[model samples]
Target: MLDVAINHAVVIDTEKSVEKKINIGIKDGKVVLLTTDTLIATRVIEAKNLIASPGFIDVHGHVDGYAYSGELSACQGITTTVGGNCGLSPVDIADFFARQMRDGFVINQAELIGHSFSLRQAVGIADPYRQASPEEFAAMEQLTRTALQAGACGVSFGLDYSPGASFVEITALANVCAEFNRVMPIHTRLFTQNDLYSLFEVLAVAKRTGVRLLISHFVYQYGTGIMEEALQIIDQAIENGIDVKIDSGMYTDWTTFIGTATFDEQTIADNEMRFSDMVVASGKYLGKRLDRELYLKMRKHYPNESVICFMGNKAEIYTALKKSYAMPSTDIGTYKKGEGHPQIAGSFPKYFKEMVKERGDLSLIEAVTKATLLPAKTFGFAHKGVIKVGSDADITLFDFEHLKDNADFPDRGKPDAKPTGIEYVLVNGTLAVDQGGFTGEKAGRIIRV
Candidate 1:
């Protein structure tokens, strides 16, 4: 008998961009059969009037085995998440993987060795504004090699978080990633909203080192009336034989800690961001805007407090994801239930609602492909992203009409509000979300490259 079977569903064919009514059989956490045969299984789900697709792979997230965020990701049909993004990750990818393997996360996690925050600190570089010394570079390079050999999927850089990370330091690590044929996911630094110069700096590493580059959170960086121009540069880079791809979230606003270099006085002034546009997203000051007094207090005492910066044009979100190489991602962080940005809970559902169902920016097949296969291919997860025979039994079933995002910002309502229409999600043939609620199962594995 099969482990599980779903009969009579509109199964998505991502490779061919088609949909067909088909029955699927699963066993041993793998897709075992894909035919019209009526098969018996230990458990069967009647997928009447439902659409079944390969589970989403969130290309940019910070889940890092944080249970609340992992559960939230599973609830949104994300069966796998690429974590340790934006230059913040566990210092030892091996230990992180070992711990997650012993204590499984809610969804499968693929990790990247982080540079700016995690590695720099590991090598005794305490100041974000001071460039890494030659000794620090040597130490970081050794750590990078160790992590990559231990199965990190890529190397990530949060340049804005470490504003002092020199291009030499960056390219040296990029060479390491290139040597191992791993990706470099970068959170490019910016001195201003129109800082196309920063984009070039990131591209220069990709161009020089011959490493594949995945620009982290594209819309957040360039959606401030310059997304079109930013995309043009990416297109040019791709045309010039640089392997470049990007992930964008559905919302225009983004969340991060108030203490990072991103929120410093000089950085804020350079980016032309206003205190009024910043709202406390988590902790005791939740929902409050930053005036001078609150900003100083938060910067001093509550530096790690999460804040939501409302920037960029909302239209820029749709525009960016409409591109061929663009994939939807959730810059999700570890947060308690109801105590983080809505992106943690709302990103994937919101992507489908806004991009596929409502806006028609992408057909259902195209949307599913972007969320699933494209990311899997980008990160080289062969078994995780497709709903074919021999692939992993990671799947999502949803109703189109009811698919939408219910999560709102802290000021508007609940920030971590769960979304609607996602009915069932499975990871490795185990139910993670059943009847739209999390099953509290620790069935997810730590994906090591």
Candidate 2:
């Protein structure tokens, strides 16, 4: 008998270019059968009007073992999240994975060993503006090797956070990642709003080091009147045999901790951003637009607090994601309930609603492919992003016509309010979300390259 069965669902086969009504049988955490015939199961999900796609994969996020963030991800139909992004992660990758495995989690996770912050700090370079000495660089390389051996999927960089990370240091670490055939995801070094050079610098690294590169938050980095040019550059790079792709969110505003160089007074001035354009996303001043006093206070007293910087073109968001190489991501940070960007709960839902149902910019099949198989192939997640007889049974079933994202920014509405129309989500053959509500199932596994 099957452990669970989903009946009368229109299943999307991302790899095979097919979407057909099929009955799915799950047994022992895998999809054992896909047929039109009837099957017996211990539990059955009636999904006649629902579209069954591989569970969405968030390619860029910071939900590195935070239970609330994982729950939010699961609620959004994201069965797998790639964390350790933007130059911050647990220093001990092995211990991080081990702990998550020992103490179960709601969704599957894969991690990147972070440069610019975690690796630099681990090698005793505390100053973000100081170049890594030769000895320190060697130590960081060794730590990266250790983490990769311990199951880290890739290496990530937040170059804007570390101004002193030399080109040599970056290439050397990227070379190590290339050696392991791991993808390198980068938050490029851009202090000014229109700095395409930062984008070029990353592309140049991929060109030279031969690392498969994933650009994190493409719209946030270049949506300020330069998105068209940025996409052209990426297109040219790919045309020239440089392996590259991008992940973007639906919003123009991006969030990060107040203490990072991204919010430094000089950096803000360089970007020509005003304090009013910033909003406090987390901490005591949640939902308040930044003024000089509040900004300085948070930077000094609550350096770890998250702030959302509004600085991109709204239309450019779709313009970026319309490209074949671009995929949607949350860029979600660890936040307490009711205090975070709406992306934490709304990204994937919003992606489907806007890109598919509302705007018709992407067909349902194309959107599903980008959200599922694209990231799976990018990160080498062989079994998690497809619907086949032998594939891992991670699936999301949703009603397209009824789907909508209700979560909004803290100032506008509840940031963590869940969306509607996600009927069921299964992670590793267990029902993680049932009947539009989370079931508190911790069936996700840690994926390592």
Candidate 3:
């Protein structure tokens, strides 16, 4: 008998533009069969009104094995999450993976070796305004190589967070990733509002070093009404044979810590961002918009607390996601239930609610493909992100008609609220969430490069 079987479900074939009613059988954490006839299994689910698709893979998240964050991710139907994004990750990649293996986790995790913050700190370079010395560059290269050998998926750079990071440091790190046949995910520098040049700089890296580049949060970088032009530049780069791709969150606004260099007075003035446009999402000032006094208090006292900046254009968010090359991601991190940006819990559901159900910008099959196969192909995760025989049995069953995101920003309600209409989520053929509630099972594994 099969380990698990989902019956009478509408299977979304992401590779093909079709959805057919079928039964899927799983055993040994792999898909065993797909057919219209009844299947015998040790555990069977009757999914009469649900759409069964390959499990969602979040390509850009900061959930580095925090249990609360993983619970939020699993609730959104994400079976695998690529964490260690945006210049912050645990320095000991092997030890982090080992801890996950030992303690068990709710979702599969693949991590990137972060530059700017993690690596610089590892080598005792505390000043974000000064370039690394030649000696420091050599040391960082050695650490990167070690992490790659320990199964890091790639190298990530949050250039805006470390303005002093020079071209030499970035190119050197890119060379190491190239040698390992790994991709580089860049959170590009935003010199000002409408900074298309930042996007160009990352594209130039791909052009110069032949490294596969995944631009993090395209909308946040170019959402000031320049998405079309930014996408054209990416298209031109792709025509030139440089492998460039991007991932974007569903919303226009982006969140980060209050103490980062990005929130410095000079950086804020340079970007033309007003303190009034920022809201404190965590800690003592939760749900309050930042005034000069509160901003100073948070900056000095609660430096690590998160703040959401009400910037970027909504139109640009939809426009950037319209590109077939863009995959949906949640910039999720560890936060309390009622504190954090709604994007942490609502991104994927909002993607479907807006793109497929309401506006019709993308077909159901196309949206699923972007969320599944596209990221898997980009990152070279071999066994995940497709619904095929022998593929890993990570799947999501949801009701298309009734699905909606309940989480809103901190001022509204709980950002970690579980979405509605996600009926069941299976990770490694084990029920992680059943009938829209968590099953208290941690069936996830650490996926190495």
Candidate 4:
């Protein structure tokens, strides 16, 4: 007998561009079979008129074991999230995983050993405007090796947040990642408006160390109308046999800390960004636009607050996602019920609705593959991204016609509105969200690389 059976469902197999009605049998958290065979199960879910695809994997996120954020991710049909992105993460990967396993989470999480912020702070590299000394670099390398051995999936760098990082620091870290065969997810350095040199810096590291590189949030990095040129660079690198890929969210604007190097007055002037173009995304000034006075006040009082910078072209978002090597990401973080970016609650649903159902740029299968198999393959997770027999029993059921992202920016409306038409979400053979409602069960696990 199987633990659960999802009967007569329209299963979307991401490996191939096909959809068929199949009955999936699940036992011990794995798919046991997929057939018309009369299978008996402890509990059976009748899934008619619903499209069942592998649960979405967010390639870039910052959940970092935050409970509310994990719930938001699960509610958005994301069964797996790659966290500790953009230079922020818990210092001890092993201890973080142990605690998650002990308390039980709401979705599968794979962590990366973060640079720029977490590792730098751990090694006592306090200055963000100066390169680390040789001794500090050595200490960082040791800590990085320890985290890699403890099962961190990759090394993450937010170079823009740490402009002080030199070639030696980046190359040394990349060398460690390459030696361990781990991915290097880089949020490249941006020193000026429309700067491609920052992207090239990461490419240079990939060229030097031969590390597998996953560019973090392509739209945020190059969505300033240079997406086509950036894609060409990535294509040329791949042609030269370099493994380079990117993940992007559906939004053009991106959010980050107000006190980071990226938000410094000099950076704002160099990037040609105006205070009016920035909006307070979290904390006391939640929906207010930025000004000199407000910026100074927020920078001092709310240093850790998040602000959304409106700096990218909308057309570039589609341009990036249309690439074969690009995967959809959320870049989600922990936020309170009514405070956060809309992408946290609406990215995957918006990807399907806009790219597939509205614009017809991608077929449903292609979009699903980008959201599912592409990420799974990138992370080397064998059993999590496909709806085939013997795969993990993580699945999402939603209506193609009715699925739409209702969440918008704070000035527009609520940022945490639950999307429409996500019918069911399951994690490890257990219902996390049922019929558009949370089930109050945390069945997620920490996935060690």
TM-scores for every candidate against the unseen true structure: 0.99, 0.99, 0.98, 0.98
Better of 1 and 4 by lDDT: 1
Prediction 4 TM-score vs. true: 0.98
Error of 1 at 393 (Å): 0.3
- Tens digits of per-residue lDDT for model 4, 105-125: 889999999999999999898
Which run of 10 residues does model 4 get worst, by summed lDDT?
36-45
lDDT (Cα, 0-100) at 143 in candidate 2 = 91
- lDDT sort, best first: 2, 1, 3, 4
lDDT for residue 285 in candidate 2, whole number 0-100: 93
Model 2 alpha-carbon drift over 4 Å, by segment: none
Model 2's C-alpha root-mean-square deviation from the true structure amounts to 0.8
Local lDDT at 69 for model 1: 91
lDDT of 1: 0.91
lDDT tens per residue, model 2, 1-449: 89999999999989887899999999999999999987779999889999999999999999999999999999999999999999889879999999999999999999999998899999898889999999988999999999899989999999999999999999999999999999999999996999999998998899899999999999989999999999999999999999999999999899889999889989988888899988899988999999999988998999999998877789999999999999999998999989999899999999999999889999999999999999999999988779998899999999988998889988889989999998899999998999999999999999988
Q: Tens digit of lDDT per residue, candidate 1, span 13-77?
A: 89878999989999998999998977679999888888998999999999998999998899899
Where does candidate 1 stray beyond 4 Å? Answer: none
Please give the lDDT score at residue 90 for candidate 4. Answer: 88
lDDT of model 3 at residue 378? 86
Best by lDDT: 2
Candidate 3 overall lDDT versus native: 0.90
Worst 10 residues of 2 by lDDT: 306-315
Candidate 3 has what TM-score? 0.98
